[model samples]
Target: MRGLSRGPPAARPPRPPGRNGPAYTPQRMADVSAPEPPKPPPTLPDAEIAALREAGRAWEKAPGRSSAGPEVAPGLDVAETRGRPGEHYVRIVRSQTQGFEPVAPGWLEATPRAIAPDTDFGRIRRRLRTALLGSPLSIHRVLHERLDKVRALPVLSSDALSSVAYATEQIVLILAVAGTAAISADLLPIMGVIALLIIIVCLSYRQTIKAYPQGGGSYIVAKDNLGPVAGLIAGSALMTDYILTVAVSVASGYDQIQSVFPAAVHYRVAACITVVVLIAVANLRGLRQAGNIFAAPTYLFIGAIILTVTVNLFRLITGSIHPTGTSIHIPMTESFTDLGGMVLVLLFLKAFSSGCSALTGIEAISDGILAFKVPEWRNARTTLTIMGTLCVVMFCGITIGTEVL
Candidate 1:
């Protein structure tokens, strides 16, 4: 049969008026073309169709599909259009099955289309996505590989650990407001207390990891043991904590940069935004890239802080340093203070609460156990332990350094 062109057919002369004002001649119109018969759908080999149909039967019988039935039709994949007029390119279908000799998922992509894929917008979209995020990965390529303890420490803990960059700064800033005397007298004790708090939190999480090997946190614990409302509250609190971490980290980082080049102080907002964007883009590239990119800074910060503290400790032990004196002089902000015992405690507690915000990012590894490699839970727990140990050391050292140096 001839194909009907998408363009209009040949023009016809107008019908002439008759005695009845119009003609009604069905028989005369027989010369005109009739609508074409519908083409039967293309099919696969009987054996292949039978296997697929049988395989899809359970899926077809599932609740949502019950009304429409299996998408497979009369032993045809429907998607397969070979042996029909539209068939052109070769079709390569990988058999879907489990067990040994697993099929590779590449040369495995296909999408049923009325037009060719290369000519479709899908090409442009895929290309753009690839340009932005590297090559596309097959769904099968997702990993369960675990991180070793050293690598895991930074990969899973960078966010929480970044707080070390500014936690002490924040504490000192707050304590300085009362007076230089007030800061010198109270800063060490408050910081030490906060460091102790960090250790306790880390130990508590260790217990939590062991107790809930499946990775239950405050939300799950609250839900399971304390009911849904408590779980919701915990989740909301966590969200708030994360938001504050992002904001405070950026703000404090801005202050640090400002210290080095005070002129950049005005650009703080823009710089912070750029950093956040870069972080988001890195994370979007996947966890592997993120770990590679972020792990260095975390360790560098730890190494620098630890090294500086060790020097101070050596000096203190050798009687070459006085703990009462400040190391690098920090210009004091103008402030007044005539506080007594209880008011001082309140001020210190408030500062500690702000510094404790560093703990916010610790939940990343706990919440993401499945992202770890083989023996997922065990590796995740090990990572958590290492991170906790690092956090303890860093917190204690920073406090001590600030106190003595």
Candidate 2:
């Protein structure tokens, strides 16, 4: 059956405009007529405030200000007070006023006591923290404790120095994928480029330290010279870089641990967590203590690397040790001939970029200029130079050693 057709629905008439620019319902009308919110209380005048303070001081100083009883003259008195039935005691009295009143001569002084947190948990937490991190230092103590170049080198340059432990491996691993020929052809060039970059960066940061001794690092530099946006970007990038640095450093150390003790390979996550916690606790022990704690390891690592490299070079020069050169034959999986010129160029570029990880912490000295002793910028610059030199030497030495033997 067909349904009857219907016409379009009619539109309702618009409401008349109200005084407030729109149609008013009962709620709107009420809101429009409602009283305004109470205004904020007016501030007291300076003269009135001063007068109030004066009155308060006068009240505080009044002779009869004591709430216990009326004030009495200062004098010595021995009063017999009943303690119990048929028992009495003699009490020595001096000033009658209490609360901030001065005591008479020979009167025992009240011992000063510190107010501590009431909860046992709070006390336990505080004591545990103290045990783990050592006593907290006052601002004055921390300020007086500045780093010398010797100590500052390890503290500020550790991250950059530590990266050398793996940066060469990263470069080699990338190049080796293309075949041994690629490694022989590209490794030295990549190392040279990275070293040059390092020198340039170190010099540039020396200038940065001179210009910005106050040391906010890239954030302050970018903010002042460029804009806030650029500063924020630089700051965020630094945070991300730091997080990755910690992760990489920890992983590298873990790999070394596994190499020494194969059983440790099973507890990778646990070991990483433990190491991170220990590092955090060490840092919390204050900067001076942290430096002292880390100084030994940094120096030991430098010495070991230098000694090993020296011995290897000596042996090579004397022909006492034979070199293990890379194979010239192409691998079946991947070969340079198959990759073509552009791909090989890209591969070399990738390896060079990977090797640049050694430069990760180069800005640390500039960023922490105030961490050094007197003539902070000079000391920091010196430390930076030392770090750069060590990095270049160790890096090149390691690459050359790997290539030869």
Candidate 3:
């Protein structure tokens, strides 16, 4: 005990990493020290302020834009003599009444510089955009080339047109649930009516696209004829329809694939998410590239349907195929009303309405009218007409092919 007391206590061993200890470094130490906010600079003289305002007015009143943006050549204002220009600091408070004070003087003495494409953060952003999409198109080059009728039809019509793949399936699924009642028999007349409705909807849209060449679909119609409230309602409804349509399309497309390869069912979310992300990225690239990317698939789909329809119609007309559409059973049912006449009427109405949902995505074309090239209205109108006719023919063809197949 005497020997231990003679010397200072030996230093304790370094603590291991745990609740009491963490790894430390000079960088971390620096980060921990909070830097003081920079102070605002002194106010400018009234003469200099007046000169800046005059320069601003001159820039605004300038007849045209110079190569380097606006030329504010009213007079030169004196800059601060003490420090380098624009090297001061200021705080930007969010309050409207308390704006950030100008940190530099005589900013209006020189013409504004056009931002160089390769400057600072701009270079990083452009590379990112180019990597994700393609080269950026100029404002004038946007919608620069008109889509000939062949390209426009597929470009504008894909959403409505792609419905053929599943619309008939949905209709059949609904009717066949009646079970053993020869449900397929009613498919023809119901489908014929649906086909007619599709045509009518297309015709109405065609007229609308022509009248409002700067298109915004039902929203525009409501805004133009009715009031803003009506326009808002239409817009909200259209948005709801678009979301639901995408959900249904994703689900149905996934299910179709899942039926063939059961493994795909496990990755359903991933598959759908990938599709959405790809579509978003493609579109953000600008209209020309997006159209180019979409045109091929859309036309291929159209071509396949046309071929199938052509083959089936040819067989039917040649009497080589038997017509199975006329043999399905019909069912009678009632709600709590014991199937009243009005109830049956409502059922037919409901069925027709359900089938008519195939027409949901038709409004997409109108939303993109400006994407049409020179003579925008005329090209948009023509594209719209072609879209409508294609939608009608495809919907009808698919319905008929359900019987033919």
C-alpha displacement of 366 in model 1, angstroms?
A: 1.3
lDDT of 1 by residue, 69-130 (tens): 55532222223446767778555543331111223433233222322245658888867876
lDDT of 3 by residue, 11-75 (tens): 99875765766855678878888998999874998899899999998998889855576655323
Assess the local accuracy of residue 59 in candidate 3 as a C-alpha lDDT between 0 and 100: 90
Q: What TM-score, computed on C-alpha atoms, does each candidate reach?
A: 0.68, 0.71, 0.65
Candidate 2 deviant stretches above 4 angstroms:
1-115, 325-336
lDDT leader: 2
Ranking by lDDT: 2, 3, 1
Candidate 3 segments whose C-alpha is farther than 4 A from its true place: 1-126, 143-148, 180-182, 322-344
- Report the candidate with higher TM-score, 2 versus 3: 2
Give me the runs in candidate 1 sitting further than 4 Å from their true place: 1-121, 144-146, 322-339
Clashes of each: 4, 0, 6
- After the best TM-score superposition of candidate 2, give how far the Cα of residue 29 lies from its true spot, in angstroms: 69
Which prediction has the highest TM-score against the true structure? Answer: 2
Error of 1 at 336 (Å): 7.5
- Candidate 2: give its CA RMSD in angstroms: 22.9
Candidate 2 TM-score, C-alpha based: 0.71
Comparing 2 and 3 by lDDT, which wins?
Answer: 2
